[model samples]
Target: MATSGGASCSSSVLPCAFSRHYLAVCAQDGRLRVWNTDTQSLHREFVPSAHLSATCTCIAWGPCRASKEGPQRKKRKSEAGPAPDQQPDLLALGTAAGTVLIYSTVKGDLHCILDGGHNGGVNSVQWHPEQSLLYSGSDDTHIVEWDLQTGKTRCKWKADRSAVTSLCVSPDGKLLLSAGMTIKMWDLETKEVYRKFTGHSTTVTTLCFATSRPPDSDGLYFLSGAVHDRLLSVWQVRSDGKDKNSVVSFTLTDEPQYIDLQTADSKDKAVRLAVVCKDGQLHLFEHFLNGPCKKPLSPVCSVQVSSVGAGEGATPAPVTLLAAALCPDRQSLMLAYGNYLQPIVEKTQINTSERHVCLVRDVHTTLSLSVNAAVSKVKTPIVNEQKGKVLIPGVPGHQAPIRASSGESDKRKKGAGPTEMSIEERLEQVELSTLGRKGEDKGASASLQTDSFAVLLVQGLESKDSKILNKIFQTKKEALIRNTVARLPPPAVLPLVEELSRRLQGHPFSAILTVQWLKAVLTQHTSYLSSLPDLVSQLGVLYHMIESRVKLYQRLTRLHGKLYLLMTQVASSNSSHKVSDLDREAKLVYEEESSDDEEASGDEGRPEDDSDSWEEEEDNEEEMDVTENKENHTEDEEDANKDAEESKANGDSDMDPENESEEE
Candidate 1:
């Protein structure tokens, strides 16, 4: 499978998995594309015939070993195995036929196929980091473990009632994590569920362990993202009684399709977290792998993976992301996206289905400040108690700088020179002065003129923070909601509606607030929004979401009423022997009254029988008039028949005379 030139997946839109040295891609055409990470070139390609015509669904790469420098390390490296590149890095490809095809990249051939363990299509596959074992999850709701050497299944157990969509193994190879409708941690020794994590509201599709362990913490950290829930959660997999298993969670603006973790090149050993979302955007974060976890982790930066070439003000052509991986450097990202506009069969003989991977550079360096740098840049202030002053490092004090004269000597009059301050003192004074100047704007806004709550609400609506948006909707009154929506910018109107639609789904308790916001925005901008194509599309999506929610509520309500009726009947039947005829009649009367009350409540705003009476009267009068008309028509037809008969007799006599004359 090794090749010198660049290569891409031609007929594949399945998942891509990468190791330290290689990246494996499963394409729709039942072929596997493995690329060398260091060289950024195609290493090998495997054909679909090897998989027996089943389409690839997911892929996983075997762990590759890295080299060390010290003599002791060198001795261990020599004994560890072959060099990383020469080693037969295994690529496990899961297919829709309930089988796993393990291919060795160095050998460029199909190594083995693990089958018969699953009865349904395979959804995810993962390799043990240190052991020669492979695990796979399928639609059959079972997780199967396979021994790589024997090429046979070792054990299989039910992971979830729903299909397992993702799998992740711990670095120590003791715990296995499977995600479907929820996330479950399994004990490898017992082959039983240790605990379940229910952080995600919907299906969890992706899971990844942190690149390195956190300092002072024995628990293993991992990340899980739910595509349908649009949420990402960081969890610690340990039975530490003092700490919570859940470290932090984030609500994403878009559904996350993939997540990759890389160790940042810093002294603090921060982790570089990259998330590929459904909106064609890649969100990057520099988080600590050593310190205490914080709430509300925000991305340092977001990169548009799909709209790389789109010009300003132009709608980008739709592209489907097949796979995304972090480069070996961790500062670069490899994005594999499909161009739908390009024809599969071109006029030229060459196939344009494959293209070079889109490499996004400086993913980590693009942050404004590194985590270590930020910590180092901030210094504790020094207080001079004798002088009654607080002197902060890198901050300027109230003193001004002294300008030296060109002709004057260094030994000028000390009193005239204002007792020359040391260089450090002058630097501190300068820093303090700069910071002080920046704070003057607060005084300007301290006047009566200030930003209105409506403006603040608009800012919150435009913000990417879901917390702020949720809080505003949940706490603010209807008047403020209306005012804020009225002040929304033209470009932000569509997005506001879209956000409200998503909020309504995840936070049904906020549905009333969401509806208020939606009503105000659409009512205020009805004319302006109707002219935009994007608005039309967004409104269509919002309509569908609201319709689905309405249907679900209606179905639940009907089910609840049926259950209540059944319970009431059961209770009544259980006590029927103790009740007399009078009690039964009274119970029936109570039911009738309750039903009548419900009907009255349902028809509260409707007019009384007057409207129905008028409609009924009109219908009866029209029917009576129609019957009278039919009777008159029958009488007229009879009269016309008699007149016609008389006319026929006269005409017959006249004709007889005429015929006689003709005969004569």
Candidate 2:
């Protein structure tokens, strides 16, 4: 191939690579040319169209890190399989005749022609390496996605105006960027037009995205060359954030007809700028990776060329830059020059290569490179040793979160949930089975009681009335339990409950009202409650009254539990107020109910009468050691139960749910 007038050599696409060692040029001549980028010499890669009418207008290179997804399979398996080994390095050529040809590096080899591509001229092509999608823009004003594996168009939709002219995929393959007069974004997944970027007024000539350091996680950034302003525009294509239109924009001096851009993995952050002129001139812009540059007034390197023109006003008159491929290491530059797409011109190579090192301050490097390295660095481990405050013990990764309980939890299991309930337990709440309920709990407020014995057992139970407990225990060998099933109190009772649950646990305390229950029980008051009581009952009528009263008192207990826990959690929780409220209430019961004469013979096991008999009997008697009667009046006590039963009927009218019994 040699130079003719070079006036109107209609070059379609110029594929330039600094790292690939070759300049790829696709021209209207229906031929592909490869040139050495650095030496401006010709490399061996070249391919020509099979038919005279085959004119390639666009070309894109496939990914180097080819998918392990093997050779392309057919709709039906072919007679013979291709060679098991295949390296994907080819020019995906888009032609004017609406067909695509896979041009390999080897010249004179049969090309893999993909026809039936577009209805009109295939103007541009790009490969999305990550998406495994091929984007081809055509004069049909559409971008078509080809199922490269199936050799068919996956989907096609209208894209740019005045015929789709250009396409580019991001390095990380997150976006498929295409342009004509306006930049249109197509989603990689659904191939839908996401957004149209319309900053350029004239036809867009070139498009490229900034590559992230890791070559992945590269976000939206594009460099576009436009004919309208003769300015190379740099835009940040942010899909997310306030600036969806354009986040940032930079302009170049020339009206770029053909432009190619790249960022070296140099990690220096500098970008490479290469543009082909309508006049046969090439201007190169080298950006250094040093740091942020406010503007491009001073670039790292600039190559101002006049190779095609001999004199000052010679006018290079370059038609189009079809392709420019550099070496794989970006150490060279190759150009496809002249009308015949001949003379693979090599350009002045930019010397940008620098020595790479593993960071100077790295601990591993310092440890390995030092001649006087510490013994620890080179020594082999024989046994486990604790290093300073940190312990790196070799333990097997096998242990349940719930091991054998040793701390607070152990006391609970051993103290509560025993095999059997004792005699006093008959007075307390106990469920028959955990398997399932045979009958619904209709006792009192059905909603009030849950399987709340669980709370009582949370780490064993504690109580303020140890003597009342010991005395009660003497009447029968029964279980001593904690009052954990108390309901939480409301905000009004928040201070009260906090004071009580805490005092109940903290000091010679008693139960009171609280915060959690106030919050918990808006309507479902019966959901969480105690199924058992704290004390053993000896006086039948009194025991019943006490059961009712204790149930009421424990309301504060449950409420206090919630409040205590809450106040501990919430701010300005007045727990002491609850303690005082309880003290006042306790005194009222003792003073109004007990008299000396009634205290002598005392209220003992009476019949299952109405609540007033217990209240009346409670008013008659008050003293410690009700357990003494267990032995003293075994026979008489059994007899008095009958009269109390008769009297219970007389006082049945006064029993109230709230004020019924205070013993519990």
Candidate 3:
């Protein structure tokens, strides 16, 4: 646990089980560590291999037995016996040497090693939902299914031409999902590909299923992100061919490192997806897959890890975020930065009038300190005075009392009250500040001062002024755009979408902002818009415009790339155009000499007795002609003689038989 000024725990794989009881992390130093939820301490640690060079590459915790229980099982088992009380937790750690080590948490012992299948480093490992089968993907571009009971490979197949980076099993245990160069779904029984999705433009490194399916959704919802791509896609796993279309694709400012899906709130209805980006920010998205939404998924907020524990205006040290997982309660996120594990909690501030106010700015202080505090409360080790031998805590009826300081109790009491204003209140304060600044700038311009962003936007749409609308949206934030759209009358939603779409045809630079506003309006009034039958034509027009704009942008991007390449070539040629006249003359002379040498060699290699060869060929041709004529003359003579003989024979036959036979 001691380290130098800077060191990173290997950023390989960090997996939190469905039950959220344990979090398993692998390090570059070939160490496998497990952290417990209850104790919040290092539950156990072990090296995956005895080889000093072995490095852990990926980790997977088996599905908890208790999570398999549901209403259907309860109804079926009403007449049957009760289930077992506990099952040992199984952990699978894949190493860089193409070896997989399985261990049991109950006994903390190595169970088996699966090393015969992969010839390259293992990239990912996933557990089957309802069986003892384990699926592992390796850099060899092969997926191997291992039977845990017998410690043997049950099946192995090539998943992709590229290394399979991530794997997930469907909840019903009927399908297996793999991602690498492309996303593919496979039939668990036959191992044939069910469907292929080419939505992501780069290599996909993460795949996760929603914690729970939203009732409004028709298929199993899941999330995928590529480490090299700046977009996160929400896809539906359907038995029907509707899986080709992704539910939504979210654009981000930075490439995503990890994605975790959980409930947005205590209701467990809305699906919340948290994407941890390489830029050290956690992007939170809500209500993306729960309802009938036709808009793009946008992040509600982004929390920066470095800013969480830093004081106001103090520069925070940059840290590389490797992975993130939501705790079971959805109140805290565990972030892995190199070798350090940090917990960021969403502190709930209780207001007497309002139920709760979330303050995200006060979350991180290192979970290691908490672990140390917990260890301290457990009492020191006991030693025998007679033999000076060591003893474990609470083994010899030594129950030490836990003492709490008064200041700690007081601090806990004060923590319950609200210490800051809510988001709405902050927005109102910002609005006031903005108004004050505007009033100071334009005291005599009453009309301009009276109109707010929403008013200006509504007026622009009513008058069909594209310039006004574009100017209004040029400098606004996403939240401000959404708020402005929400302030519009319900009947104006269609006009907003139409205006935004039309503007997109003219101004490609404002597409991002216009799309933001358009999505906000559509999302806010989805039910209202879907209820109207007469609006179908307008919606179609909007979709057509969006599709055309996308095509246009893609074409522009391609053209820009070509132009850039051409310019680069021109620039290089210009820079290297300073060839000296002497050098050019030498180059031409060398070329001329080489050409002359080639001509001389060509003449010398050719046969010098060309006339003699032609005479011999002519003589051979004449001899062949003479032989052909002689053969023809002989055949003609033979034919004439045969005809004469036939006539003589006929005459003889006639005299013999019919001088009697009328001389044949």
Candidate 4:
């Protein structure tokens, strides 16, 4: 498709106009074309034959109503008895030569032209849905409200020194939004600026108003996208016009060419926005405007308008989406790229057995190649050890190995022993070699290959067999499991952790190991886990279980300490009582011994002093022995008491105050 002079183009959809859908496209080529969307065929074309240099820069459809107090209105009422059942079809066209052409859709003829309002080319034109008033913005920096009935300008004002590029009206039809260097809201009745928003640092290119209530307040909000700044700002306008708030804003990656808001159905109050960027991509987003505080608008899907070919060795042609319109049925989105119009259809399917519903792009309607699919088609060849042989792994026909020459084969047979040669011959050499090791080096390679825990974990996960995972858990050490858990991808880690926890529940030692592995993983991946809400919640439950186990262990330890202290105190008291009894017995024995010795010495009047001395010496020896015995007994008792006391003191020092109180 070719266009005239590569002028900026625009398109709009007339919903159910003339009992059928129509798409109007203006390419600034001095001509306008209307397409029947249902048939995907051109319905009508308009060209200004008098103005050979004219170009249609913009176009808008008037509201589906006739003026109540105009001559045409009087003619319609006279013919249809004061109540016309149908709406009048009006189309407004803005040209580059400073003209606004109003045409009748039913008659396909020019109705009237509104000129002399702007001294420069018109940039944008919009019609009020509730009134017959038409608004136009021109490069003359003027925003003129034209009275369609009288073909006269009701009010004109300079919006800014720059050209007024875009215009939007509130759904209530009480305010007008004009975008030039900045966005300004004008009170329709007073023709005075109510609020001026100045966040955009560059020219404001396009503007749209949300059809649903804004999330922040019960008011109408408008969205504006600007060039150079790459910002999309949503501004809220209250009913009384006392407050203007910049509710939500988004920074687009690419400069947006056009932005449109569409509602799929009346029942679904949510609005979906279609943004066309300069990079030839169409982005679809769901605007969460009516639900909660500061709800973010999220991307629904995106499609490239043009694709770069792979292996073609040619530069892809640059394609830019100038305009887009959602059909009235909401099933198809039409985009204008250069002079071509493309339709994108929405496809959906339901799985009855699984009770799942999913949406997919229609394969037949897409005109551009998918980047992923195109990339997948490219194959990188791997060079084999033999020269000039390229092996493409995973391809069925490339599995065979290139045969070696007789000399090489003889050298291999001689180097490898007879047993190795026999084994290689008996088993498929190609299969074993393709597994990354020769038959003779299998034992050495196995040990080296098992070093990476990540490789082993991925291998087990990919097997999808419960027995393999179970075997791995039984054979692999806890440290290896921890390493694997730490290294696994986020999507794979959660399921594996859950499976390990379940399998290890019956065995406390294994469960403890699993808990340790999970803790290590959580410690290493705390930031990543926070982003996945469901996985974080699951991990939290597991952590709580582990914490309860730890608390139970601590309580048991405290109980053991208290029991030990009680035993020490009881042993010390018993030892002291035994020492007291032993001392009393020793005192009684000593007294009796002394009485015997004195009686014997007085009663016996022996003539020999030597005999008396010998008897006293014997008595002294016996006393010394008894005293030594008593001292030894006392020493033994003291040692036992000392040990018990020391143990009690040690226990007291080890025990925390809180634990001691709880135990008591």
Winning model by TM-score: 3
Residue range with the least summed lDDT across 10 consecutive positions in model 1: 341-350
Q: Is candidate 1 or candidate 4 better by lDDT?
A: 1
To one decimal, what is the Cα RMSD in angstroms of model 2 from the true structure? 38.0
lDDT of 4 by residue, 480-535 (tens): 55555565555455556556555444467666555555666667666655544233
**Candidate 1: tens digits of C-alpha lDDT, residues 361-450:** 222122112235434666779867577843221110111122223333344343343234456754554565567765443422221111
lDDT of each: 0.60, 0.47, 0.61, 0.58
Comparing 2 with 3 on TM-score, the higher-scoring candidate is 3
Tens digits of lDDT, candidate 2, 104-131? 6645343466667688888777776665
Ranking under lDDT, best-scoring first? Answer: 3, 1, 4, 2
Q: Measured by TM-score, how close is model 2 to the native structure?
A: 0.41
By TM-score, the better pick of 1 and 3 is 3
Question: Which candidate tops lDDT?
Answer: 3
Off by over 4 Å in 1: 1-13, 36-41, 49-53, 65-88, 211-218, 238-245, 263-268, 289-295, 305-324, 327-330, 334-664
What TM-score does candidate 3 reach? Answer: 0.45
Query: Pairing residues by index, what is the TM-score of model 4?
Result: 0.44
TM-score of structure candidate 1: 0.44
- The true-versus-predicted C-alpha distance at residue 87 of model 2, in Å, is 7.3
TM-score ranking from best candidate downward: 3, 1, 4, 2
